[model samples]
Target: MGVHGTVAAGFEGVREEFSAFLTDEEHAPGAQLVVHQGGERVVDLWSEGVGGESLLGVFSSTKGAAYLVTALLVQDGFLDLDRTVASYWPDFAAEGKGGVTLRELLAHRAGVIGLDAGFTAEELADDRAIAARLAGQRPFWQPGRFFGYHAFVIGALVGEVVFRATGRTLQECYEERIRAPYGLDLWLGLPQSQEPRFLSTLPMLPTPEQAAEIEAAAASPYSLGGIAFNEHAPGNGELYDFPNSRAVRAGGQASAGGLGSARGLAGMYAAAAFGLNGRAPLLKPDTAAEFARIHSEGTDLVGGMPKAFGLGFQSYGAHFPVLGAGAFGHSGASGSLALADPRQGFAYAYTRRRYAFPGGAAPENTRLLGAVVRALT
Candidate 1:
């Protein structure tokens, strides 16, 4: 297999950069890259071992879609961000979290990161099950005072609100409003018919040095970081295997069970920010700005590292020097990244069927993204 796809006239360098990155990889990354300059796709490329249309597990990048759904509802006045989560789902207040606003919850401030006892794989795959269990779980930190990743359950919590408010599953709303309408390849709840294009996500192939670094920073299975990722759960599978399960794909565990290609992702962000296919943008300018504004910054309590978060998206300006102040997106365990840079008038996405060396947005994005941005200018 070799690099295959198209690059618009000005983005030839992006194709060269993608080829160069795959050539240097010891393992075939099976990667795809897509860039949209406003609503017009400027680059579309894929490397060996994966087709341009293959839908691979996007891990946390799924949150970008989930957040977009939430933003739309808020924009339409179907949901209120300032209202307490308890107002929508009363059970959410059982653990003295009655006051946690929907805004705080989206920013990962509700503090019900994971179940105190942990979830079985089946429960973890079902957002309703996850939400029910978390309703009474005590917050690891005071609900509004501290923030953590809520790596596996934020979607369930937020989705519960959508369900209670609108009487529809978050997945249903997404499919009806975004995926089907746009003919996107991304699936929140992948149907049986679309399973042929699905590809299981590959685990990270870490270097000896990277493995040592992981071991050195290892936390207890019951620690906040571990629980947040469901590492403490009995019989919980590896993080990389979450989307490999048919149950997970069917249920569309909103936090991380999304399956998509680079085209789907880039198209999504482009639709939100720039009106894809000549249609109106999914989100109005005010909604996009509100979601992209920084809501939380400083060290992440669960990951124990510096991070920045907006409504439900990763704020890039503080940490990613290449992006402007309002750029927002999410990175996944498979080294996939997707986002819209409103100020720069572009949307970009990269996906991998093979996990990257260290994980969390392959480092090559620096060069690849730099190439795309430069081409735009």
Candidate 2:
């Protein structure tokens, strides 16, 4: 099926790139792409199997919202990055993580990647439960010595602090200060009324060679990476199915349960960095820079790849050549990518219903993003 949407006059290249990407895929991706120049949406498009407004699981891209909320709280002086996790949630000190500061946790250096006993599906569905269980767990590495991807629990770790400091859940903070104020389509806690718009994320259809590679590279379920992704849990469902559960979406796990369309992702970033809907930017210039600054780099212990992060956000500029050094955001397992390039004066988001091979941001993003830059120039 042909792509359906509108692109501002100068952004026709983006449409071409999007169409070409769909044509190249062996299976339909059910993708949505949106970009905002300051507060103006320059491109809005979707493909077969989904509508432009349909919400899909955004996986770790939800972490971008979690981090953005943290940044706003810091900007308002409600939370201090230098404070120890134990200072906020006292039980966090039960482990050797007493010295681990909010900054260290945001950088993925607190080292409590997962529990010695993996979380059950019910516990994993609740952020507070995840935090409660992990609070007394030991760090995989010496706290503050190294950084790795928290994968499924960063939101809970951070959210616990948010609650202890402000008597509010991160999801509550996000909805009140960010989502509801701007009327963003993204939701940490999806309501029953929005159920009809959500499309279940389809599993990846990897080629034979890709499947072989995946099997060859598979880590033991008990390995650190496995634990981080909750693969070690007995009878745990596939990662792709996490958000499909009404319980997961209702509780709003925060780490990966976010559901929204590309427009919502784009608008959130636009509001945070560029002031969407003619409102003042949610974050100050200094706050944005601090979160965008590189906090960790080099091979990740959990992902086993060269990765970089800034406060809880991925340093997208390092991964996407078309973006500026200040571009910060996150990607999800369903090949979703959303970010704000403050230096470039734009925010971009792409969400796909079908899981992309290799399980991360879809490779087509580079081509699409390059096309956007070309159009802007």
Please estimate how well model 2 matches the true structure, expressed as its whole-model Cα lDDT. 0.92
Question: What CA root-mean-square deviation does each model show from the true structure?
Answer: 1.1, 0.9
Q: Per-residue lDDT tens digits of candidate 2, residues 261-295? A: 99999999999999988799999999999999999
Q: Which stretches of candidate 2 lie over 4 Å from their true place?
A: 24-29
Task: Give the per-residue lDDT of model 1 (tens digit) for 185-272.
Answer: 8888889998999988777777789899888888999999989988888887888888999999999889999999999999999999
* Model 1, residue pairs in steric clash: none
Question: Candidate 2: deviation at residue 338, Å?
Answer: 0.3
Q: Which one is best on TM-score?
A: 2
TM-scores for the candidates: 0.98, 0.99
How close to the true structure is residue 288 of candidate 1, measured as C-alpha lDDT? Answer: 92
